[model samples]
Target: MLKDFRAFIARGNVLDLAVGVIIGGAFATITKSLTDDIIMPVVGALFGGFDFSSYFIRLGAIPADYKGSVDSYAQLKAAGVPLLGYGEFLTVVINFVILAFIVFLLMRSVNKVIATVEREKAAGTAEPAAEPAEVVLLREIRDELKGRGAVPPTA
Candidate 1:
């Protein structure tokens, strides 16, 4: 069982999957940064600096003893306020869309490169050129003549 486990771990697919997971995790951080730091900021600027993440609706009434201001979503939530966090949801949705688009573009480029490599490999490993039609006909005729003893078969 130990040997079998080791063999399973050593398989090419398993190793590839592990490596892919590690790389994907690292890529996710970069994607998140790109979305949060760059894309969202530009989008916010376009929308007159409105922050989507702080948008929320209070569901439950604020407690009388609550010391924190109910103005901000974070403060209200921290003060145990029931809320519908639509802004945070929208922010997450935007992040997801950006990440998905970036991944799609990356995968498309990778697929194109893979396809190019495959085409090159196929061309490089192609069979030698075929004999011309005239050559084939002449060869067949020579073979028939030789078989009928009308021509000698050359070594």
Candidate 2:
């Protein structure tokens, strides 16, 4: 069982996927910070200091003086205040869309590179595939035998 487990853990796909997930998680953090810390602030500044994360609807009987920041969400919830967290949701949605677009643009670039390489290959501009010796010999033999009137009986 332990050997089987080890083998499973050592599989190439599993290791690669694990590494990819870790990298993806790290990438997500950076992107999130880019959106929340940098991008949102600029966008907010453009709208005259309108913070996107502060917009929310109060659901409970809590007072309207609740400051709605990231810290405020926890406070409001801790005070047993029922609230609609639409602002946070909107921010998350925007983040997802931005990330997807960036990934799409990256994939588009990679695809273009792949297509260029393929085109080069098709145009014989790339390294040629070497013909097998047996195939070459057979083609030569066939061409030579084609001229012979004496029918070599097909085996």
Candidate 3:
């Protein structure tokens, strides 16, 4: 069972998947930072410095013991306030869109490469793979035998 598990882990697909997952996690962090730091700031500047993340609707009253400012979304939320954080949701949506677009572009390029290779193959322009050494050696032996008349030549 351990050997079977090792074999499964050593498979190309499994290794590829593991690498993809790690890259995906790193990519997600980059996307989040891009959305939160660059894009959102630019958008806010365009909209006269209006912060979208602070534009949530308060569904419940602030706690009596809460000392944080009522206008701050993070503070109110930390104070156990029930609020509809649509702005934060919008930021997450933007991040997802950006990530999806990048992935789409990557897939598109990969598909283009695959199509070009297939077309080259169909046109017989692609270089043929080299013959294996064993096959070449066997052919050499056959030629030597045929030259000596030990192996009959084909009609």
What would the per-residue lDDT of candidate 2 be over residues 67-92, giving only the tens digit for each residue? 55444765787677887888888889
Clashing pairs in 1: none
Could you tell me every candidate's TM-score relative to the true structure?
0.73, 0.65, 0.71
Where in model 1 is the C-alpha error above 4 Å? 1-6, 130-155
Query: What is the model-wide C-alpha lDDT for candidate 1?
Result: 0.91
lDDT for position 74 in model 2: 59
| Best-performing candidate as measured by TM-score | 1
lDDT of 3 by residue, 47-145 (tens): 899988888999998888989888899999988899999998987888889889989999999999999999978889757889999999999999999
Would you list the rank order by lDDT, best first?
3, 1, 2
RMSD of 1: 4.9
Model 2, runs deviating above 4 Å = 63-74, 121-155
**Per-residue alpha-carbon lDDT of candidate 1 for residues 69-94, written as tens digits (9 for 90 to 100):** 66788888888899999999998898
User: What is the alpha-carbon lDDT of model 3 when measured against the actual structure?
Assistant: 0.92
TM-score of 2: 0.65
Considering TM-score, which of the candidate structures 1 and 2 is the better prediction for this target? 1
Residue 116 local lDDT, model 3 = 96
